[model samples]
Every structure is written in C-alpha cells, then in structure tokens.
Target chain A: MSEPTPHSMSETTSTTDDDETQRSTAADPADPAASADPTPVPGETGGKFGRYGGQYVPEALMPAIEELTDAYQRYVLENEDGFMDEFRRRLREFGGRPTPLQHAERLSERYDRDVYLKREDLLHGGAHKLNNALGQVLLAKYMGKDRVIAETGAGQHGTATAMAAAHLDMPCEVYMGERDINRQRPNVFRMTLNGATVTPVTAGRGTLKEAISETMRDWAGSVEDTHYVIGSVVGPHPFPAMVRDFQSVVSEEARRQAIETIGELPTDVVACAGGGSNTMGSFAAFLDDETVSLHAVEAGGADLSIDEEAGVAPNSASLYAGEEGVLHGARTKLLQDAHGQIVESHSVSAGLDYAGVGPELAHLVDEGRVIPVAVDDDHALEAFHLLSRTEGIIPALESAHAIAYLEAGTDTEAGTDSEAAGDDGGEPDAAADDSLGETVVVTVSGRGDKDLESVIEETAARDIDGAPDMSAFTEGI
Target chain B: MSNRAVSDRSGNSEAIAQAFADGPAYIPYLAVGDPDYESSLEYVEALERGGADLIELGLPFSEPIAEGPTIQGAVVRALEGGMTPDRFFEFVEDLDVDVPLVCMTYYNLIYQWGETEGPRPFVERAAEAGLEGFVVPDLPAEEADPLREACDEFGLDLVFIVAPTTEGDRLDRIMDRVSGYVYVQARLGTTGAQDDVSDQTAASLDRLREYDVPKAVGFGISAGDHAERIVAGGADGIIVGSALVDIVAEGVESNRSTAAVADRLEAISRELVAGAERGSRARSTGDPS
Candidate 1:
C-alpha cells in the first residue's frame, strides 16, 4: 500500500483499499470517531491524533521501507505480551528510568516561584536522548536486525546508542559530521570507547544534515543488514512516530509524577526544542488539556530578533525563517530560503543547531496547538551561570535557553527597575547579576560538562577592569 | 498510424526471445537521426554486423521524459536535424536488418500521434518500422494495456518497467505482459552519472525475478564498472544509455570530425556492448561466482 517515491518518502500504507487518494494524517488517541475528522490538525493526521506518519522517498526504496513500517506496526499490535512492561523493567532496573524530578529550592525560594527540574541530565548519557536510543535498540533487537546505524550531533545520542548496541552485541556505526567530530571531540571519543565506528561524514555542510546524508548513504548500501536508528523524531515517516512513541514515556512519567505531587498536570509545561524531541515528548501527553499551556523555548543567540538594529539574532528560530518543505527526503517544514534551499540555522547550544523540527511539530504550530518562544544567547549564558551558582546544577547551554525565556517576559519592566535599582543585594555575585523575576519552569535539558570553556569566557567578559556600566545588562529579553 | 510508427509484426517478438534464449544476445541502439536517412540505414546494417541480438530503434520525439540533459539536447538537435515520423519510417523501411527492434519514444509524442484501433498510432507506426517492442518511459504499468493490445496485434512487445519502488502487487502487474525484459530505473534523482549502483536496484532485480521476467536496468549507467555491478546484482540486461549519448555528443562537440569521433564512439560502444553481452551470459547462468 505504501508508495515510496522521491515525493512520497514515507511508508504510506492506506487503511482502506482506496488509500491512494487520501493523504495520511496523524491519528487521534482519544477520539473514537477520529476517522470522521475533516482537517489534519498538527498532531493527528486528521484530528492531529496519530494516523499521519508515513515514509516519502524515491521510487527505489519503497519496498524496504514499507516492510519496515509494516513490521513495526505488526510488532506494536501483536507484542502485547508485557513488552512495554519488560521494557520498563529493563530501563528501570538496568538502564535507569524514572529520572528524579529535583526541587530547585534555591531558585524557588529566592524568586516567589515554584521551579522544579526534570533531571534528564541525570539519565545515563547526560541528556534525554538515551531514553529513545534505549527504546529503539530494543525495537531493532525485536525486529531481528543484527546491525544498527545512527547519526549524531554533540555525540550524546551516538554515545548512548553505542552503549546500547554494545550491550546488545549489535554491530553499530555512527555517522558524525566532520564539523561535529571536531566540535564534540569528547563525545566522539566516548562513542569510540563504546565500540562504535565513528564514521566522519564529509558531505554538504558537514553538520547534522551531512551526518544524516552519510547515514542514509550507508543505509542505501546496506539496507538488508542494517536498521537505521535515527536520533530524534525528525527523519522520514516512522522515525518521527517511533522516536516520539519511545520518548512519550518521559512525559508519561512526568504526568504521573506531577499529578501525584500537585493533584493535576502543571498549569504550564515548558521544554527546550532541539529537533523538539524533549519538548514535544514532555508536552504531547498533555496537549489537549486546555489548562496546561505548552511553551517551547529556543536558543536566541546575541539577539532574539535578527535585524541590524536588533544587534544579533536568536538561533532557535526554526519556523521564523523556515518554510514548509522537505529535508532528508521527508516533506515536513524546513528552514529554507525562498528558492527552497536549506539555510544555516544558529543556536548557542550545540544540541539546538538544527534547521528542521519534526513535521508533526510544524503541524502543531500551524494548528496553533503550541507556542514557540526564542531566548537570546547572552541571557542563556547568564541563566547557565545562575543555575550553576544558585542550584549547583551546571545546566547545559541548550537547557539555559529555556531558563532564558522564564526571564524574557520580565525584560522591559525589570530592565528599568534593575537599572534604577542595581544588584546591591546579599547574594552570590552570579545570582545577583541574573535576578530577573519570573515564575517559570525552565527545562534543565543536560549537564553543562560540555560547555565549561564557553561559560568561563562569558563570565570573564564581565570583569572588564571596572563595573563599567552594570545598567546595560538589565534587559530581560 | 503512419508507416514510421508501425513495426513489422512477422515473428519479431519470437526472434528477440529466440536470440536471448540462444547465444549472442543482440543489443542495438538507434539515435533518432544520424548523418542522413541513408546513414541511418547504414547504421542498422552496422548494428547487425556488430552482433546485436535485439535492436532498440530510437524514436525522435520533441520531449523525452527519462533522457538526461545531453540526450534531451541531442533529441532537440535531432529534430532540428530533420528527423520526422515520415522520414524515420522511410529510412527504417529501407533497412533490412533481420534482428528484432524496439521503438523507444516519449509518451506525449506517442499520444500526439493520435490513437488508431486500440493503441496509439505510434505503436501502429512502430509495427511499420519493423521493430519488435515499444518503450514508453512516462506510461505507468497500470495504463499500459492499450499499447500492449496494439503491440500484440502488430507482434511487438509492450515493455513495462519495475522501478526500485515497485511493490509486489505493482511488480505483478508490470511482469504480467512484460516482453523483451522488465526495464529497471537504475537510480533515484534525475539520471546522470552513478558512481555506485544503489542496493535498491539489487532488491528490485531480486524481487522481479520472482515473476520469472528478465530484468534490464537503465538510466545513468555511465561506466564499464557500473555494468559489472548491474550484472553482479542479478540484472539480466544492462542497458547503457547516457554513456552512449555522451559519446555521440562528444562527436558533435568536436566539430564534424567524423572519423576521430567515430573511432572513439565505436571503441567505447563495442567495449560496452561486449561487456553487456558478457553480463547477460553471467546473469542467465545464475553464477556470477
């Protein structure tokens, strides 16, 4: 039923015999009469539920992709013999699941706000990427694939997948962009140590996109022997669905924990959107809960808006400059130019330096299901230093962007007040400098072990011989 | 149907099958126009001497869907070079090459030729041209029956494709009446130079074998090395299209210095043809080992 063509990349299996006419949409989880829905909202194919996942590729690889998609679907339906229970057991006992939700007592009491941390950083690979990698590796094993191939940025997903593949004794190959190989040297070493062949990809841009290109090339060459374990929920058809299904446990657990602690889901759900895995995973389970507002904070480098007069632009703006097109063969929304060429995306965090988000997320933005917020680089650095000093959590710069938005709304009023009333208070110098008030849940995405130098340099920039003009740095935006 | 479009039915399909079944499979190519009509007649004789098992008579259409920029450009020039349906058939009717020939053209041109009886006039004219089959790149397997019926009446095979993406159901439809061989699209993206044959081609060939049809992969098969890969991957025939077009284009590029360019073209084409013949033997035997 699936027509895998260049234009139709995903494994689009029609539910009905007359399937060729209807475009696949995401399925709705709660609606029983979902098929009767007319429009494809962001999440469900029609109701923005779940039916929309498909593979669109060149005419060559349709059969293979269809086989895989059909296999995964069959596995999902038939493997009700406590597969998830067993998976949960393995993750909880061996790989470590239910990562603690830490109370940021310091930040909470200091500002009159309740700020808690979902410590995905404490998870095995120092980021939330491990959760999905573990799940995918399990899925591949169940499917009888002997080899695993993946592309990685910042080496977090690559290292985690390497660890899983090694534990499973599955031969693993990780494609890293030549640029990323240089930028994330430690992760590359970790992957090597974990018994993964780190293939340096020298293709277009030599970043995540190039790494993906190399991975696809590897796949096209060895489709029979390999299972392409994509890092995020952003590739072709089933990857976005599969990875999201795996990462859903994050929010599932969070929802349970939140309800047990506070009697209901949080009034506001916030996470950083790097390919939107953690953000979407954390917000997905509670999307239709009208009271629960979802906020995805993106990295805004020197400036949130990119204009000469605005000084510098924020890096986390995928849709702002992005157009709805295709990248890596899937027709989703992409950050492209008017001529449909992909544009280079910027973000202060290495994890966030991607040009495209998951297509479902684009649909969410289209249907107005989610609100995207961008935070500047300087503010993210300030947040990183503040979280580290005040809460003893060296939050990743990627995570710091979420923290930046928590204070972004206070930019103008707090800017004037702080200019008039300087940080002459009795607190650590770092926390005092970052004392913009807001009751916000900033996702501390990962530990900042990778960002020590950048943090040091930014902090060093503050001690310019004199206090110079402390008033200049008081704006919240 | 004009005289040019209709091919000679008289045992031509049986002859093509007989050639493949026996020894020395003939692989002849026809550019829309070469030198003059007299030269095209000479070219057919030249192909027969060169040991062509089956002749593929090129139909010069204005727009060829699967042709690369080079072939497309040449086709444009070939048209401007005074190749027409009437002129094309008049030349073909004169040539007495005993081998079976397949007429190849774009669907739009065939559609424009108008319909006669069941199939398009082009297929009818293909029978008049003394060809054995018709290769329409734009026509899908589902819609090939009209041409198939016409080709059957005229004793021409309506060759169908099984692209890399063709699933089992689609493959079944494609191989149901496929004659000559199931033409395989070699790669994704617009066809040009393919350094390495994609694994999808192998999968497509392997799957097509289930239907017991001979598989022939074409489009962007540029090198001698590519022929080896195609053969190794279980392809029954490797149709090298772009590389041949490049040779002819090179001849045009170097002015009308026919002897020099002809030497290069003949040498390359001979080497390629010989390799393809060897490949067909290897694949037929099912022992690349």
Candidate 2:
C-alpha cells in the first residue's frame, strides 16, 4: 500500500476552532479546583489528587515527612529563583534538556497516522528519569542533606540519581531488587561507576516494591542527613507532587513544539504507566486542553483480561484490575488479592512491573480525563523491533507498549486512521469511520539499551528454522 | 479492691492510668507466635510472673518497615511458622495472662483487614481478642484519624510515638491525642539494643513532660542501666523489645527448649523490672539530677 502525505493526513481533521468547540462541549473540561490552584494550600494535610493521594506512613517517619514537606514548600516551590534556577542550569548543562520532538515519518506512514515521538530517549541518562533525579537532588542539597537514597526497578532511575549525586558531591545509595539487578546489569554498573552504593534487597518478592520498602526503612533510621529521592510519582505527599512538577517540563516543551511544528496540538498524547511518572509528565500540560485526549498504556504481561480467582493474565494493569488500597505510603489503585495482600506483577519490562500506579493517574482515570489500555508482552516486543527498523529508534520496553497500541489499532478513536493502517488487519476498522484522521504523539520514555538481552532472547525463542518471522508473531493480534 | 479509687481516671485510660499510678511500668515486647504459638503464650505468662506491668504483643507481618534486624528476624520466623492474622487473633483470644495486652504491629496488617474503608475491623477484632490498645509504628498522628476514631469507638487506647526528632508543634500534636503512655523513641534509629542511652533521651523526656501524658521510652533500652537512666530521666515506663526478642532468637538458634527460653526471658525481665523499681524510687525522691 502507498503511504499518504502528511498534508493529506492533516487535511482530514476538522479546523482547529471547530475541534476546540467540540472538545469543550464533549465533557466538563478540567476540574476548576485542580486546574486553578497550582501550589498546595497551607494546612492541607496530604497532597491529594481528588481523594486518591495521602501520607500513610509510620510514626517514625512523620517528622521526616513534615520536615521535607516544609523544606520543599519554602525552598523549591516558593523560592524557585534560588533552587529551581540552579536545577534548570544543571538540567541544561549536565542532563541535556529541551529534547527534540521528532516526527516519525516511516512508522507514521506504516500506521497511516501523523505520529510524533518526544525524544526523551536522547536525554543524558538515556531516559526521561534524569529530569526528576536532577531536580530532586538539587532540592536535597538545598535542604542541607549531605546524603541521598533512592530505589529502582529497571535501574534507569538509580543511574540517573547516582549521576545527579555525583554531580552534586553527595554520598548516594540505591536500593534495587536482586532479580532486577541481574536483568539490568549494565545500568547497575553505571550506577556503581557514578559512586553509588547499590544495596540488593532480598525481602518480599525481591522487586521494586521491596526496594521501596527498604528505602523507606533506611530513611526512617537516617532521616537527619539523608534525603530519599523517590524515582517515580508514587510514595507519600510531597514526592508524587514534587516528581510530577519536576517532570512536567516534558509535556510543557512537547506542547509548545507540537504547535510550532505542526500548526496545532496533536489530537492525542500517549505514554506508558508504571508508577506513572512519565505518563503524568507527558499529560500534565494537555490536561486542560480538552481537544487533546490523554492515553496511558500499561504493561499487559500475558493477557489484558481480568481473572479474580486465578489472577493470571495481564497482571500489571493496576488501573484496570486493582482496587483502592494503601501501598508504600500512598492510597491508590493496587494489584491486590481478596485478602488485600499485594499480588506480584509480571512484565517483560522491569520498569513497568510494579503492582501500583501513581495516585494522580488513578484520579485522572476516575475523572475520565485519561484513558488506560493494556498491551501484552508479545505486542510490546514486536513494537520494540518495529520502531528500531522503521524509525531507527529503539524504544524501552515500557515505551514500546504505547507503540504496540498504535500497531494493534486500539487507539484509533483517540488518533490515527480508522482504516487499519499497518500490516495487522483492516477488517476490524470497518465499524469506525475512516474520514476522521488525527495526529498522535507517543513519548519514547527511554532508550532500549538496557533491554537488549531480553529482546535478543525473546527473538531467539521465536525463531523458526534459524530465521525469525517477526510479522507472523504480530499478525493475528 | 480498696485501691479502686486510683483506677477511676476514665474507662478508656484505666489500664495505663492504674499502671502508672502504682509505679514505673515495665513493658516487655514479644512477637506473638514467634517460634510457635504455644511457646509465645508461655513467654507472656513468664513475663507477667516476672513482674512486667504490661505486655506488647507483636503481630508478625511480611514487611515490617520500622523494625531492626533483630525484630525483623523474629517476624520472619513467626511467618515461617505459618502465623496469619486470623491465627494471631485466635491464639490471643485464648491467651491466659494477668497483664494488659497491647498489640505492636505494622499498619498493613490492620490496613489489609480494613481494605481502604476504615480500620474498624482490625480494631474491633483486637478488642474482641482482649487487646487493650494498639501501637502501629508506621501510622503517625497526622494520618491516624481513622484508626484513632475506630480505637475510641472500640474502647481502646491508641498509643502514639514521640521520637527524638519530634519537636515543638509535632510533639504537641502527638501528645494531645495519645491515651496510653507516650512511646518515646530513645534514639534516632530502629528497634535495637544500643550500648548507652542516646544523649538526647534526657532532653526528649524533659520536652515530653511538658504535656500531660505519661512517657515510656523505647528503641534501645536493653540493660538495667539503660532502663534506670530512662526512667530516672522522667520516663514513666521503659519499653524493651529487641533485647527480649534476641533471647527468643538465641534460644531457637541453639536448639534450647521452650521452657529454657521462657526461663531466660523471665530472668532478664526480673532484672529490668527491679531497675524500673529503683528508677521509680529515684523519681519519687527527686534524685536523678
């Protein structure tokens, strides 16, 4: 099939004014209470997203949480001139900010959509995680804390934090699960080379959850001199709000760049959600823009269907299958069993292998501001290869979930052509109208270097007679 | 029965008030079902015989974030012995002991039972099982309204912790709602036996005395000297956990019989209880300075 021109695709959508009118009338735009107030009101107990977020920690850590919250409010938010300026300087000189928003031409043609890739994979630590790390480490310094600690699943956050600590001349320690350390060996080495002490946690299921619990324990003991720079938008009050504010630059820049490059905002914005930092960052700017739909793709592991008794397939989609419960200090949607014991999550991408998501995403999901979908391991693996071959950009397994959704035509309503663009199948597109063509932006949250081993192993297993039929694997799904 | 006048403070705070009115309270902590449920019961009985004023029953959880290695190991051993929340309550309901029992556990066990609705289920069950109060190490005073409300409705005192780092406003907030003796953390770290009482313990106790609640110092009071110093510094009770838990762990590691472990625990409990008595005498005589 011949590829359509970008101009032809752009012409298919309605005028910008008409689109804006339709979107404003489609639903009650942003919650005035949330959008109008930027800073946390004084005496507000916990930084809440609707009713989803709260500080549910032990008494031993309350004083520390209070101290950190005070410091963050006074030094970082109120006096941004002193702290945030230095943080932004470091982000520019050391962490490489203002990353390009590149148009994925070949892949866009294959999908018959105008797809733009926010190039966070080109960041200093090869992921968008450095944005939060640099900003938080700066705040730690401003708080007069000489030591820093963090927890990691795929080690990207650990590597980014270690790099920031090295730059700031602070002693850094990172807690990682023993299972994750083995899989993400390269990033672990990178963290060690940056002078971080990587402590391997062996408690519980030995994954991200255990690492976070261990980090909290360490902070409880050494709260005076150490600051725990939580990697994702999870955890207690100031952390989820702070990390999201630090990462908001991702969407802020992308929103401006989309208008500058394509004359208007993309019809839909997509990102992957684990603890939901990148998703929140990519969706924060467009939340008030009713015309732009926000979609988050979660790791599906095996299947996207729910099974309460067996709890087997699509084990990682907390928003889809989880109930409201408290975990690691926040009350959010958690993948828990009937007795409230947290169930172990399975995902090929270690970054998205958590059993809980950020409470803010939970609120957005509840408000219908954000749509969540799940893509299994098979589809993500296929997208990981397709992006490399078509766009010459190898995306992290977590980001590949977003690409997989596009390939599977699951997000056609949000964006893309309804004619089933890609080689998958056009038969499913007969029900929807093909006249409405929309532009979509997918966030390449990180580089795929850490996942090369798993990808090679998976490809080797799918090989038939020493030749891998990549198309055959992704055809039916 | 003639001492009934001293126990008339209030129905909810009677147990702690009576214990404090008599003398310094010596509280020993043991993880319930550690090693086994039957032995755990014997340990509690031995503590009561050894003159313990009250006992803290620990509910073992898979993740005890506020615990040091000593208590963490005990929790692991208890869970390995197939202890669950249901079994813990069943054993506690039938436990025969003289001293009042307060549960010391992480918040997740209670939170899991409540399941994001409220902490009423766990508090009600604990009350049904004869528990007098709860000390959730992780549920701070600021986020404790739900559990505190449940505790009040169930006629249970909710004990709150006052750490060395807890200062002016935060200390006042924690002390205001505390019904039982205030749990004063002697040091800046997790539960373990330290060589000496923290230098800040004296000042922390002095600050805690500004409030009306009785103070009990914990988180490293192992030896008699440590207990005496804490109580002499104005602490109404001395809370010891790791030292007693270490005895249970050591006994299990060395293949000692349950009776031997109980005897060892009782012997140490007697020494600490004597130290608490001496400290009480010093406080009454105004001689610690």
Best by TM-score: 2
Per-residue lDDT of B194-248 in model 1, one digit per residue for the tens? 6677877877776776665456777667665666667766766666555655666
- Candidate with top lDDT is 2
Provide per-model DockQ scores: 0.08, 0.43
Candidate 2: true contacts recovered, fraction = 0.45
Q: Candidate 2 DockQ category?
A: acceptable
- Tens digits of lDDT, candidate 2, A122-181: 999999999999988889888889899999999999999999999989999999999999
lDDT tens per residue, model 2, B1-289: 1122122113364666677777789999999888888888898898888888888999886667778888888987887676777888898887888678888876766877844456888888888888888898867676777777777777778888888888877776676568767888888777888888887888788787667777888988888877777788888899999999999999899999999999989999989988888887887899974
Task: Mark the 10 consecutive residues where model 1 chain B has the least summed lDDT.
Answer: B1-10
* Chain B TM-scores of the candidates: 0.83, 0.93
Whole-structure CA lDDT of model 2: 0.79
The superposed Cα distance between candidate 2 and the true structure at residue A418, in angstroms, equals 2.3
Clashes of 1: 55
Question: TM per model?
Answer: 0.62, 0.88
Candidate 2's TM-score: 0.88
Top-DockQ structure, candidate number: 2
